[model samples]
Target: MIKYAVHILFLILVGICWTPAEAQFVNLQIRVEPELSAEVQQELDFGTQITNSGRSQIGLGDVNMGIFSIRAYYTQNVYLNLTFPDALIHSNPAIDQEIPMELSISYNNSGLNRPSESTPLPSEGGLVAIHENTTNLTSTSDIWKEMYIYVYGYIDIGNIPNGEYTGDIVLTVDYD
Candidate 1:
């Protein structure tokens, strides 16, 4: 039959001159950083113990040192410092003499007013610049902000000879 139709039209012109295949590409990278921390949930109660009835000018007013909460996890925007240890010693160890006391700190946070760089603690204890970030806390959406600590005391107990007195206050959070 004419050599089988010329070998089936030469295999259909070699399958219509076949040709098709080519394409490729690639790329990838990643980097991230930002995290800080702080903790002191709640502890700073200066209550109940205040006995200087002899009164020669001993004002123990405001003394509601409760709810001194501070549970931060910041990444940025921070400036909270409260360091005092210049004087809060009351060691008389049988006339060894060491009675000095004076500390005043105020706060109601969110209303923000304490960070004046703090000055006045020499008489006993001082340094109260509670917060200076001015509400720009920025803890990266962990949803945490609370500052409600108030402690005020000034004693002159007429020649100082009483007893029992201890102190410790150190709260610092950097990055401003």
Candidate 2:
């Protein structure tokens, strides 16, 4: 029993002496960098601008149910015009939107506005309907000093208007 006890004590001592080293007392530092991308659009013909000066191409697919809403904003009275190709019905410049007055819509597509589609443009003059975006716009124009405007629209080419008109599309967004 005495020899056995001695052997066990020796074994314990050997085990303690041979023990592997353990990592201890470490100083660690960490940091985080967030990545972000955002968008804003002005020219409706082109896609919305995303973060900085990036541009996205706009197309028919973006129009929902063939209907579109556009807006324009200017500090003072501005001249907004629509044009028709020379071949179609004679255009009369007298027709225009008066102050606080912004845009004019054919209500329907005047096929003449586009290429071959000569069908009368849908009549949207008397009652112009522009759908509003439910989402609150987060950006502001105070930074850019550019006019902001909005217009409700649809593409109805089967019906022609008094004359084919040319119009510029506008999209309102929060950023530059």
Candidate 3:
């Protein structure tokens, strides 16, 4: 009986003396890259035009056009969407007149200066897959590609009130 009690006390002491195991940790790391970017290199300007009795048109080849540049990962596909205004309102607050306008866009993945040579996007806007040849590598380590966008506008001037008119154009871009 005494031997058994001593064995139990010895086991209790051994359990109380035991220490917890050590904990281990590891270091984790990651590298974040830059996001895609777009910028308006040139503003769309119609300049000064005298309204005639009939409809006045501005072709895609017109001098008054907008230029935009987009940059993204090399060989990565991106989508572009454009929201166009229905009309251009007169600058005068008192003038309650507006001219009906239409807008069109074109793109060149090759970054060519020729807007006419580029592919014409729908007036309603749609997705454009960046061609492999259109990529202009901006960096080597963190590879980046660039493309150009051209915008044109046309207005119907049917003996409407002549004054400075303006509208907004919104362009949205995202990775595919």
Choose the strongest candidate by TM-score.
Answer: 3
Q: Model 1 compared with the native: what TM-score?
A: 0.26
TM-score of 2: 0.17
Tens digit of lDDT per residue, candidate 3, span 32-141? 76667788888877667667644555566677688898877666677777897798888888987777888778888764567767888776666765544634544585
Candidate 2 vs candidate 3, lDDT winner: 3
Could you tell me which 10 consecutive residues in candidate 2 have the lowest summed lDDT? 106-115
For candidate 2, lDDT tens digit of each residue in 95-165?
44211112222221211122122122232222221222223445664212222222323322223334434
Model 3 has an lDDT value of: 0.75
Give the better candidate number (1 or 2) by lDDT: 1
Query: Whose TM-score is higher: candidate 1's or candidate 2's?
Result: 1
Estimate the overall C-alpha local distance difference test score of candidate 2: 0.30
Cα lDDT, all candidates: 0.44, 0.30, 0.75
Task: Specify the highest-lDDT model's number.
Answer: 3
> Model 3: which residue pairs collide?
109-134
The residue-by-residue lDDT of candidate 1 on 26-115, one tens digit each, is 676665333344444344544334445432222222223323443333223445456656444565546544435555554444423243
If both were scored by TM-score, which would come out higher, candidate 2 or candidate 3?
Answer: 3
